[model samples]
Target chain A: MKASEISVGQTFEKVVVEDLKRTQLVMYSGASGDYNPLHTDDLYCKEAAGYPGVFAHGMLTMGMTGTLVTDLFGAENVRKYGVRFTNQVWPGDTLTATATVQDIRDEDGRPVAEIGIETVNQDGKTVVLGSATGLLED
Target chain B: MSDEKTVTFPVEGTHVMMFARSIGDYNPAYHDPGKGEGNPVGAQVAPPTFPQAVAQFDPEYPLRIKDGEAWFGSGGSPSGIEGKPATSGGLHAEQHFEYTRPVRPGDVLTARYSQGETWEKESRRAGKLTFTERLVDYYDQDGNHVCRARGVGVRTERPVDQG
Candidate 1:
């Protein structure tokens, strides 16, 4: 939907992923070069360092949410996106991300759309929260 | 941490494609370089969050070249009062991204990393929580700003386990 046609409180489609896996974590580790044991080492995460098991990167979740924004306003249309990591995302957990149109208005003679985004786990616990701004293509 | 930490690297299609795959973003525009032929924004495009992963290209990054275990092993105790496991990371509190233009493959981007403001708070998990914000701004070879990432790294006197 174009930014101008979007109304306040209009929630977009929910993007869902199920049973996040250990290999996914490994892939992110390899790609981002963030080999933090807390993220990639299942042994350390589970027994040594003291976590349940491997977990997803905070940016991973944020990136998922960003994809939805890009889908709506085109990747290049995004002006700003921000997020807060509220909870840990573990293997076998399912997540759902939703974006809501908060405001659409003119800024310095250009139309802009403001959106609120959230990602919640299967347990309905909010794992990520933030807001984003995008260019309103005419 | 320096006042301004800068690193320069050529944006390659391989890195861009790998990052997209890592995130499961199968967008063809990110993969097929030829898809941009006659397309307005030429040059295979990188995902919006690609810049976050670009830190890997920064040879001088604080944690660059360190394996997962080594990175964890060296997290020095935040407390000057020693006798701890040497693990110091509190939590990743928040993150932000702003883009002026889409980054394309072959753009010799220069990323300027700088430490931003830091503040403290009392949290049930971390007790006396300290939040450190870091900003990374990417500019093309011609010095046009392309993107900016703002991330907050947390630290506390005591260790807080996520699990």
Candidate 2:
């Protein structure tokens, strides 16, 4: 959290989700108001849409992956955060997110930490890749 | 791609708490009503991607299953809309957020949406990807700029090849 304490290449990791559930996707749909059936409706995904089954929303994975940034810098300390959803995350998949320090520098007179982030599924396939810049406490 | 729309989003503690839970973040600072008083932000704040939840407030949001109108998701059958393709709905490709300040409960914010960029790409898994960027700027009730969210949505020509 403190600019002085963090060094480049330091990594922080957390298992964001284990055995991803359709119910969690439903909760996300209700919470975020995205009712895309590709996320919550299995029959629709399999029968109508032609996918294997229901999949997690891209935002859901991004939201889950955000725990790394929020846990490290605090939600309010985030100056900029972004991500690219790389792979589809399906039910029963486990996701682990890692954030590695990329730089510690000053921007506009404020100490900032630039961090690279990646979230991978159980098979080690990258589900999301992105970066964030957070304001340091110092 | 040149259309603009605006919606009013009133940040609520309960909504923030639920959103955090959906993301599996149980940090008391995001949910506990008075637990965040000691935080540097001085109040309970929404998660970094919480701005996307503004879809709940959009009157014409196409994602939500509205009453009287036929819904896309299943009820009695696989899909209410006949012959709807699985790849019909667009997918979120990228999202970026820049904050002037964290969103706090009780903050009534205005979200103005504007089109950004459009491009095309080809992928082995999905053919002919059309990507569009949309930008939303949030301003507090006092007219102070609070945050900006840039999102890229991609539409595939067909269902993504799983193999």
Candidate with maximal DockQ: 2
Tens digits of per-residue lDDT for model 1 on A49-78?
445666788887777667787777766677
Off by over 4 Å in 1: B34-43, B64-90, B157-163
Instruction: Give the count of colliding residue pairs in each prediction.
Output: 1, 1
User: Global lDDT for candidate 1?
Assistant: 0.76
For candidate 2, chain B by itself scores a TM value of 0.94
Q: DockQ (C-alpha) of model 1?
A: 0.49
lDDT of 2: 0.91
Q: How well is each residue in A98-138 modelled by candidate 2, as lDDT tens digits?
A: 99999999998999999999999999999999999999977
lDDT of each: 0.76, 0.91
How would you encode candidate 1's per-residue C-alpha lDDT over B1-163 as one tens digit per residue?
5748788888888888888778777777677865632234655787788888776887655544445423443234322223435343456789999899888888999988888999988877656778899999999999999999999988765546554
Model 1 lDDT at residue A78: 76
Local lDDT at B56 for model 1: 81
lDDT of 2 at A12: 96
